[model samples]
Target: MVNSIKCLLLLSLAFVPFCHCKKEQGVNLYPQFYDQSCPKAQEIVKSIVAKAFAKDPRMAASLLRLHFHDCFVKGCDGSVLLDSSGTIISEKRSNPNRNSARGFEVIDEIKSAIEKECPHTVSCADILAIAARDSTVLTGGPSWGVPLGRRDSLGASLSGSNQNIPAPNNTFQTILTKFKLKGLDIVDLVALSGSHTIGDSRCTSFRQRLYNQTGNGKADFTLDQSYAAKLRTQCPRSGGDQNLFVLDFVTPVKFDNNYFKNLLAFKGLLSSDEILLTDNKESEDLVKKYAERNDLFFEQFAKSMVKMGNITPLTGSRGEIRRICRRINN
Candidate 1:
């Protein structure tokens, strides 16, 4: 009995500081507490990324793009995790009716693996970041160390019309302007574009750049040996389908700094991505910096990801703890 009482006293003393702590309203602004770290979450994330990569080789590129678009558009609400009709929410981006369903299908596999290991512990936001990095690594790209602990947003803006998701044809200035709205600077914009190192783009996204926007004094994109010729054949200048072309020549299934290098040599697939390297010296210099120092690219990617994960979080009573990332309260 005496020993039990003494142990209780010690426990009480240990908790005294925490118990006495008072959150002074308006006085202690920015007061924060470090949430307990969960290794299980990280393990599950790694598993998901690897599983997704193995499941579908094609999805690596699209999944990485989805991660970038999600953060850039709505601060990573997992907004990319929506169906075509926007009726069903998703832990992974919806595959049905999507041009990039294969990639989202891989994401669905990852989400399932994570659910089995640690149900509701990993957020869709963190999974997106991890999956992006992993997809790149699997495709022989850089492996960035991304920090975790981002909470999933229950409130996803369904309508794409509401957010500013830039299309493949956006100009250099337009891309920069849209990125700024997300609190990213020129460096972030250029660094993020490195994602193009692996993804594929349809001819629809670049036909204008190849035919209408190319010439002496316009934009000199030195076609990669025969990439231009291939484009001409696939999407004939006269009349042809305008929806078939992969972005990267080296590895369309990986992520790397090759995208910037390609731009340096004039091989960018989309007008917007190419314009960044040629339209402004500052932008060009930033891309060069990322291409040279992949470490810097990884660091900035991690920082940008953290920033993206924090936007418009559902805290307190605003949202409920979702049992699944796809469906709400239901």
Candidate 2:
């Protein structure tokens, strides 16, 4: 009997690591995670986001990009929401963020509403995911059920934000490599790039292309010359770094395939945007396919968003549910 029990104990111990591995890797987030805990969570986020979008349709794009910036730096744990504090450097100060990222106030409003209904129950990380989905739906883009139960990171990674997030001037290979580091591929990269269809970019983000290509004092020949001339009116060689330009002039406020369409015409606003066509044949083909088929682009975009949201989430007891998004819970 002692020998039999010893053998059983060893077998059970062998399975322990496997079970833990499954839990860690599985993450186990689902659409219904908040269904019972806070039944009104999704409704609260949607209503507030809809109100914000009504006031300024661009707000939808800002909220969507907020989630992207959050996930890319620290795996959708709301680290991007954190302000600089003891032992924590804010990702907001990162190059890709700085003056570019917005929509923090909207998130705060959503958190306030959720706290009223279920105090300390809903996490800011999950709030960001839901808000992103609501933003997409509000802007006539594809909608996907956001998996919930993401916990907030106790610390933020400023270096990760700088190194991991792809820059507008990054070469196509570099951008693809950055996405790959986050477990994304060419399809996800191109499809997620479709989000640019709705947002605006500052003049500084693309001024290099307008004034100099290859460090030569000449405009990038790859850009549509006429389009560049029109851009130069607002985005001059000097000053106007903060000047805003709609990413997709065709359908700026709507999330559509017009971004890809503009790319095909060489009217893409950012070097990053034009590179989809200029740099790699595979991405170019995908861009053309998306431009030709709105449904295909929408479908892939939804899937890619979901995949992006699932990046290295802190679930179970891994991280805290932050009371205030801008600061870690005491």
Candidate 3:
């Protein structure tokens, strides 16, 4: 009941979608999709996500990241949740996801609780989408009415995951190309990159920036030298591949413009983040705008999230609602 009211409050805000009227690929996905089949669907998802986030504050960012990874590989079909079993090459082992993608147990828990209340009515893809939005709201971020009714994929894509998801060292053009392929643009890229305000990056993801950025054995000059020195204490030259560092050192847990601010200062943890400022004229301008205007970032973030969630979602009878998110239905 509390969550339901919260949902209404958040949805009624100026940024959220107002009605069940938005379309993608000629099919509609509305916040009220489960009003008949499972009235408590959103509430249940919100409650469980809140509980998990309380237990692990990082869970908020992890869950949000799962939605991004899933959508990028195969049109927001929850292929990233699959485990390796019987011809299904899980995206979990892809170069981008290997040892990086997380929050699966939280997702599993949400799926189980939802199954008891609503059976197989909610798709894992839609679950990921809602979880992302809920996660954002839990961490002092904007809220939006997540369009639902997506379905799970029967197969995972390892190669697609590797090729499609942008890498930490990917050139700005490469990252932009990847986002472009997903029907997103520079605004989406900049706003969505702001999600980094709350997440952590592994040492391996940014070690290159601290040691040898240009293959000339010199540290990346773009990074603040003092910040790079601090990072080296834990990251080292090699072997601390799994050491965790906050992406936004200023406000590691808050969802704000600090990420863009950090990039402006050359203190961004990941090369991908730094390049958002140095690499492209348009993205660079966006980084500047978001750094100065928190409200603008939040507004556009909510909008970009909705647009990204609509990437080729399966509707009508196109896909199935898996009883287990880790595997396709029998």
Candidate 2 per-residue lDDT over residues 167-283, each given as its tens digit? 999999999998998999999999999999998999999999888856555778789989999999999888998999999999999989999999999999999989999999999
Candidate 3, residues 72-91: lDDT per residue as tens digits?
99899999999999999999
RMSD (Å) of each candidate, 1 decimal: 7.8, 4.2, 8.9
lDDT per residue as tens, model 1, 167-261: 66777788788778777778777766777776566666566655754443222344444666667667655465435566767656656677777
User: How does model 1 score by TM-score?
Assistant: 0.74
* Model 1 bad stretches (over 4 Å): 1-38, 84-98, 158-163, 213-226, 237-244, 315-318
Candidate with the greatest lDDT versus the true structure: 2
Clashing residue pairs in candidate 3 (N, C-alpha, C atoms within 3 angstroms): none
Clashes of 2: 0
Q: TM-score for each prediction?
A: 0.74, 0.92, 0.91
Task: Look at candidate 3 and tell me the lDDT of residue 89.
Answer: 91
All models: lDDT? 0.61, 0.93, 0.91
On lDDT, the stronger of 2 and 3 is 2
2 or 3, greater by TM-score: 2
Q: Which ten residues in a row have the lowest lDDT in candidate 2?
A: 212-221
Among all windows of 10 consecutive residues in model 1, the one with the lowest summed lDDT is 25-34
lDDT of 3: 0.91
Per-residue error at 21 for model 2, in Å? Answer: 8.0
**What lDDT does candidate 1 reach at residue 321?**
35
